[model samples]
Target: MELRHLRHFVAVAEEGHITRAAERLGMQQPPLSQRIKAIEDELNVQLFRRKPRGVELTEAGRVFLDRARATLAHYDGAFEATRSAARGEQGRLCIGVLPTTLFHPFVPLIIRAFRTTYPQVSVTLDECMRAEAIDGLRNQQLDIAFLRSAIDEEVDLNAYPLLNEPMVAALPSDHALARSGRDAQSLSLKDLADEQFILYARKLGPSFYEATMAACIRAGFTPRLGQEAPRITSALSLVAVGLGVSLVPACMQNMTMNGVVYRRLKGAVQPKAVLMIGLRRGDTSPVVRNYVSLVRKTAKTFRPSEKEAR
Candidate 1:
């Protein structure tokens, strides 16, 4: 009839005595007996055979006991699942990421750490271009995004800085600089003035585009534009084919293109490339918050200068 009725029935069935069931339930024997009687009357079936000493379950009582236990167990499981989801321990998190962020070692490190901490939470990732990732965050299609550069401050999102590293030149292995056979300690941006330059699309990262152009201008020559690719990795692929040299985030050195070599760039001021995480400013999802907290902790170990580079 009710959960309490099932519970009372179960207690009496297990103890095989109304007195003991009442003691176990912390209730009086009379109330427990009445509740058990009400359940049997509602069902129109005999649940027990009363004996001089105690009682014994009838065939119907055994069957009802099994069903009652199952129902209670099902309710308990549902309750736990709901609580876990609310705690962010078990749920799905959809993340949008720029392709370049995958090249950074810290990206995987943080992801692995988060997985270890919340193994029950399901994580799904989408590798998107800057524009797409931004749109996804704005539309609530993505819980968070890892970006190559910060979005405009006017956007209604919070950007958390993750990594800051200087730009490096990706040169064709057979090119003069790479074949000089010795790694130069550092080279200025002016040195590449005459060489054709491969770059990422301006729309993908306006800040990086401005920084590169400003560095070249400060070095006394505008970069000779050769080709533009949608992603930094694509730009590197172009460099490997000897189309032209490209400047990429230093962490991209981890990306190994067969014919490409990464060389540090030095100048009056070396422009730094930044990796950031973007999330809706009003997001209150516990899983997203947990991930943002982990990113902040990971950023702390990148050295104070890199942390402040943004």
Candidate 2:
């Protein structure tokens, strides 16, 4: 039988009179009675006993009524769940981000705001290098990504420019520059001509490393490349060990490493670029859209405090 048959049966059973049931269902008594009879015939069982006063349910009718009500409830719940998922109120969102972004002052704010707003949506975050994040996004393994560069290769992905962070130099505490009584206020590439430098992996993304090298070249010297680190933290840690000085995003200052000192680079344009994020184009999912909006709002209000200037 169809859902209409079950509905008619339930209405007649509840009212104990076909006339009353049809009135409640906005139908006529004869059609409602025929629908119920069709349901019983399809099941090959007598579902009711008729008397001059009214109708009474049989044992089979009682059991069928319970099953019909439960089935209808299940369908109702399924419809609601589907609608919620479509509205982005309920679903899973996997986000990929650069490991360095975890230390950025505004990243946590954006995550917390999104979580608070979409309490029903579940979010998973993965910390990866820029290249890995882009790969994950393209492969559909990640819903969105936050990184230094935009995703230009994939036409299906859209990038949102968040904020720009200037690059700074990280020097070891025992280095000669650190020994000088001069505070680590500002430095020039010329000042680092004779110093060993740590570099990020060229395969990861060349923009930051290339920018640093270009600045040094503009100063009429080639940097003495000492070592290369795959990730920003590893590079900073290498600098902490007195291996070499490295150019890093300004957000690295928030990471408290004992033996590393951060200094602003002057006289040359340091590597500076807006942090752009990629999301599936036209995603329009409430969770994704809300997250993008929160990121934009956070970027506007975020001003690093003095405590974050370390």
TM-score of each: 0.87, 0.74
Q: Write the per-residue lDDT of candidate 2 for residues 22-111, one digit (tens) a residue.
A: 998999888887888888888999999997977999999999999999988888899998988777778878888787778777777777
Count of backbone collisions in candidate 1:
0
Poorly placed runs, candidate 1 (over 4 Å): 51-53, 184-186, 217-221, 266-268, 302-310
Best-performing candidate as measured by lDDT: 1
